[model samples]
Target: MNDIDAWVWWLVGAAALGIPLVVTAMPEFGMFAVGAVAGAIVAGLGFGAVAQVLVFIVVSVALIAVVRPIAARHSAQRPQLATGVDALRGKQAVVLERVDGSGGRIKLAGEIWSARALDSDRTYEVGQAVDVVEIEGATAIVI
Candidate 1:
């Protein structure tokens, strides 16, 4: 044991930490592995055991403190893409038939869709442009 260098021990610890990182997909373990590498570097440079351990702790904590916030911010963001009916909301549609509260037809997003006026009393004539307000079942509510 005495013949094996301290750097070898640090590298072994880094490999041990990497196992859980791969299995669990946890970034913290990878950070710790990086810290172990830093410790290995310090040991290879002839630093004492305490100095190597201190470097490992400092590197790991710094990586977590700085990287975690950035990672969280990225993960918390919502993609701007709206798909399916959600993409139709607030879009313009042309009345294909007389559209009123009772329902008619409209050309929306290059497709003919069942549509109705948001205001029951409001009517749209054929070829008139209307804004789609929402989707209820297979119908587009417009105004």
Candidate 2:
């Protein structure tokens, strides 16, 4: 195909790649779409098909190599605020029943929860406050 025709085809391919990126919300496809656009640009500048393909490959691979890990690292970061059962840890609760190592009950986060003292011998009387140390199954380990 002629240079203009090849560039148009490349631009069409870039648009095709972009559609999936939008639909799937996948960053990789977006990166590839960018590479395709780069290839189109090179083709418009009168480069051969081989050179255009090389540009596409290099751009896509470079983007994946450089951006993917950075994206992954950012995504893998721990949230500033805890959530769900994790948020319960380190929170204070009020003893609803006498809390001992074996078993008891506490009013925690607006719900009643089965609880046990972190220290085997420790006990918390009703109305006393305790800190949730961990959760095991349906039970809360507290201190």
Candidate 3:
């Protein structure tokens, strides 16, 4: 096909690749779509079919090699700001009622939470400060 037609086809292929990327939420497809745009640019510049294909392959492979690992590392990392129950761990709370091995109540993060002592033999009296160690279901384990 003519150079203009070839470039148009490459752009169409890029759009096609984007569909699956959006549907599957896979970054690889988006990378390939970008490569297709690179091929379209080469074709619009009047490069031969072989050169266009080579640019597409090189760009796609480079993106996958470099960006993929960075993306994976970012996804594997823990969030800097803890939320929900995780935010409660390691925080000090005031006992609202006497806390023992069986059950009690505490004001944690400004909310009343069901609490129990981390050490079964230990106990906390009202207004005493305790550290939240963990959350099991709706209950907070404290010490």
Candidate 4:
């Protein structure tokens, strides 16, 4: 331990941290790897062991604090994008069959979907264009 160079250890640590980043695809491991590389630079510059460790800790913590929140914000932005049936709402559909209160069919977003009129008494004839009001189960409610 005394004979081996501290910079070598730091480089090894950096490689260790990088493995998890590759395997798990977690950005934090990459941040830690960068920190380890910073520590290696300090060690290669002939800094003392304590100073090298301190540099590693400060770099790692700073990177995590600064970058984690930004990453979280970007990831959280996904909810603003609609998906699945939620995406179907407010989209236009063409009635493939007479749509009434009971049940019918419509071509929605290039796919066939079971449909029902938004108003119980209102009926839509075949080829009529209607707006999807909402999705209930596998059916699209339209007007």
Candidate 5:
């Protein structure tokens, strides 16, 4: 266009990026903010209103194309609980003390915790093999 200057192209690109960053941070006024940035770029470039519209369109398309794949990967990833017990679920542990049934303790992952027998009659001896069936609070239920 007659009024557009190439030197302001960098400013136009910055406005395009900044609008969405501000929008992500404060979504309520996202549309207004985008419009204002687009308007600034168009006026600064001494261009027509069509340039204002193009700023918004190009910014939105570029944002979606760049962020869509990352978003998809984040959504598909599994979450792991940070607790150590969750890491030991279904893993074998050696009983350090005969499970008292009401509340007993076991040594697992170099840590001691309250434990319960999976079967009522099952007697876990010291150094005997046991599989962690469930973890509840600070206790592990084993078989």
Candidate 6:
């Protein structure tokens, strides 16, 4: 924006931010509002029509720069990490091999995944009751 527009922008920002702060802060500083108007007037005459416009633009830019990241961070927190194993969390899969405490294979969907028991694999038949405990790297720990 041109200097005139920028100066006006600065004026608006100052007024908006100042009004709320002043009204809540002292309530007696009615002088602040009057001073703002007077300052705008004096600034307009001394700096020409362009000063307010330039100030406004600068204030707007600074505000935007400061607030943008906070907004993005708030949004980012909404959805950050995936389910599990980077993809599959509580998904069902067939037992490709008898899982012991060590490791075995689970056939989930059409893909085969390595798996192991969460605790102990004392007696786990090739085809028996099992649950996907956790997924690590390219493997799924099962029980």
Q: Give the least accurate 10-residue stretch of model 6, judged by summed lDDT.
A: 26-35
Off by over 4 Å in 2: 1-4, 15-29, 45-54, 78-81
Cand. 3 TM to true fold: 0.84
TM-score of each: 0.90, 0.73, 0.84, 0.74, 0.58, 0.47
Q: How many steric overlaps does candidate 3 have?
A: 0
lDDT, candidate 4, 1-143, per-residue tens: 88989899999999999999999999999999999999999999999989998999999999999999999998878687799998889999999999999999999999999999989999999999999999999999999
Every candidate's CA RMSD: 1.5, 3.3, 2.2, 3.0, 5.8, 11.7
lDDT of candidate 6 over 33-108, digit per residue (tens)? 4334444654656675455445445544554566556766886785566754645666667777887778788886
Better structure of 3 and 4 per TM-score: 3
lDDT of each: 0.96, 0.95, 0.96, 0.95, 0.69, 0.62
Residue pairs with backbone overlap in model 2: none
* Model 6 TM-score on a 0 to 1 scale: 0.47
lDDT of 2 by residue, 1-143 (tens): 45447889888999999999999999999899989999999989999999999999999999999999999999999998989899999999999999998999999999999999999998999999999999999999999
The deviation in Å at residue 131 for candidate 5 is 1.7
Separately for all candidates shown, the number of backbone clashes (residues 3 or more apart, or on different chains) is: 0, 0, 0, 0, 0, 14
| Inter-residue clash pairs, candidate 5 | none
- Model 1 earns a TM-score of 0.90
Deviating ranges (above 4 Å) for candidate 6: 1-51, 54-70, 74-84
Collision pairs in model 3: none
Tell me the deviation in Å of residue 88 in model 6: 1.5
- Write model 5 residue lDDT over 80-124, tens digit each, in one string: 564666788988888888884666778888888789987777778
Model 2, total clashes: 0
